[model samples]
Target: MGGTGTTGTTRRISRSTTAALAVTGLVTPLTLALGAAPAQAAPACTAGTGPYQKKVEKFLGRPVDGRQSTADCRAIKAFQTKHGITPNAGYAGSVTWGVMDLMTKQKAVGTNPNRDGRCPVNKGRVACVNLTLQLSWIQDGRTLVYGPVPVRTGRNGDETRTGAKKIYWRNIDHYSTLYNVPMPYAQFFDGGQAFHQASVSMWNPPGSRGCVNMTKTAAKKYWSLLRNGDDVHIWGRKPGT
Candidate 1:
């Protein structure tokens, strides 16, 4: 089974009029000809400056004015919408900025995520999970084989256990009896915690139970690159967990 995604409804907006309306916190109602069906007005983008306005502007590659603008609001809203953030009102609040900060760190990992040498490089074909960055990758004796793909680890109390382990079992279509959720391409490592494909957004807040949640593509690749008895080294504490 593949991961699930959400589809959003698109609305037609008159750019010139919408921009003006958004600035004044007014609704931009859709204009229709006679006898035409009425359509819902698009949600007005936020116009007030946020706490992290400057940071958000910098991240979005917009002018660092620290003030909200129509272009900036659209860019931030697009990012929030893509990442499944709620409201997505183009406000540069802590939540939106937090996600952006995580992205910045994830990007910094770059092509050499294991440069810190924290994950065991001596082990042949090891799957390394860095909970701090919420990233996972496959390596064969210091040589990178797969990714530093984004992942969602266990949340707060049910944190994913840290330490070295081995892939003891694998189930292509595993069902979590405890949580009653589908765990596709599951590879068990520590206790009930495993690496599996997640049905929800990886960027969703709070995170998983104890399982290492991955995107469908990442989970499938991990399945192909790893197998039973392969080394699995996990370390670091997940941020906010």
Candidate 2:
């Protein structure tokens, strides 16, 4: 999306074609033998609530405490101004949800500074930012949403944590006894916690030792849209929403 002139492109293609030649920069069609989704244009970006879009919109659409809107960017801006926040360059941000969560709930989440998640969006439409609540929002991966989740992390000191973090995915398996957490599942932006599918307690905050855990539902959603290097931001608490 380009500034105020945000626009996205979509292309459609046909199926059952082999040896197709490239034309007009559209993705080349796969040989029918692969059994991939047919050569079709990328879906249009709408405010619609498909399973994928719904997850994105749910986080983005909730009202700030007493105020919410699906089409009211004005309301969002007003809420931001009231909170004295920079009001974000756009609705896509890393820490927006945490702040918004506080705003609406009028409550703080996470116990330590290491807990808490961020707001992240792809460079343009390349990725999606998804965070689930376990104890703290655990740092997941830079993979497209289908990446592994629910993987275990540091217990006590090993708990997966986010914010001000600086660890890399490559180093994760080095410390784990199981070594099952994939390197790619590590969201390197935050050092401590790496993303994986694991069972962590997350009913009303402060469930994990420090790592982020996802429910079965959230793990599946995270696996669908997240990609490497999508923007992520975490806010300590919400403004007086």
Q: How high is each candidate's TM-score? A: 0.77, 0.29
Query: Candidate 2 on 144-234: residue-level lDDT in tens?
Result: 2232221222333333333433323322112232332322122333534344334322221222333344443443343333445544443
TM-score of 1: 0.77
**Cα lDDT of model 1 by residue, 89-184, tens digit:** 889998889877887788777778899999987888999999998888888988888877888888889888899999887777676655657777
Give the clashing pairs for model 1: none
Q: Which stretches of candidate 1 lie over 4 Å from their true place?
A: 1-44
Provide the lDDT at 50 for model 2. Answer: 27
Q: How close to the true structure is residue 201 of candidate 1, measured as C-alpha lDDT?
A: 60
Q: Which ten residues in a row have the lowest lDDT in candidate 1?
A: 25-34
